[model samples]
Target: MRQGIVRRVAEMALRIEPNRTAVLDWILHTPLPSLGMQTTFELACNGEGERVIALLNDLLLQPGDTVPRLPQSAPPALH
Candidate 1:
């Protein structure tokens, strides 16, 4: 089963890259040097989903990088 964090990372990547197929391909096949040459997909499946998310977040925060603002909404009403 895919983790919520993994899904969230893909959503964020789409906002940044705007190419779903390329982003998915990178997540599944690109070996990240920062991750010991492991693909993000493998990390996500190997119980390192949060790490993959963190790596993506770090990439967005890099100098001159355009990090998309996450959509904000008011908290749901309490019953």
Candidate 2:
């Protein structure tokens, strides 16, 4: 489940950012405004991994929007 979450987040990042290194860096270091300024890496550690995935999915829903939706159910499979 952890790997699935990571892959889903990375896939979403690549769809928008398209740079693997930058996406990884952002995931590990950058605090997300939507996640209440918590970095993605941090959220994942505290049982909030689904929130990160939900944010990515919400981002895809609104290409230019930055507001994050409330976390929902487990994300769909990558394939």
> Top TM-score: which candidate number?
1
Candidate 1 lDDT by residue in tens digits, 41-68? 7888888777767766766777865665
Model 2 misses residue 24 by how many Å?
0.5
| Candidate 2 local lDDT, 1-79, one digit each (tens) | 3656667777777876877998888778777766787877778777687998777776679855575333333445798
Model 2: lowest-lDDT 10 consecutive positions: 67-76
Question: Candidate 1, overall lDDT?
Answer: 0.70
In candidate 1, residue 37 scores what lDDT?
A: 70
Q: After superposition, how far is residue 70 of candidate 1 from its true place, in Å?
A: 18
- Candidate-wise lDDT, in order: 0.70, 0.71
Give the local distance difference test score of model 2. Answer: 0.71
Candidate that scores best on lDDT:
2
Q: Which stretches of candidate 2 lie over 4 Å from their true place?
A: 63-79
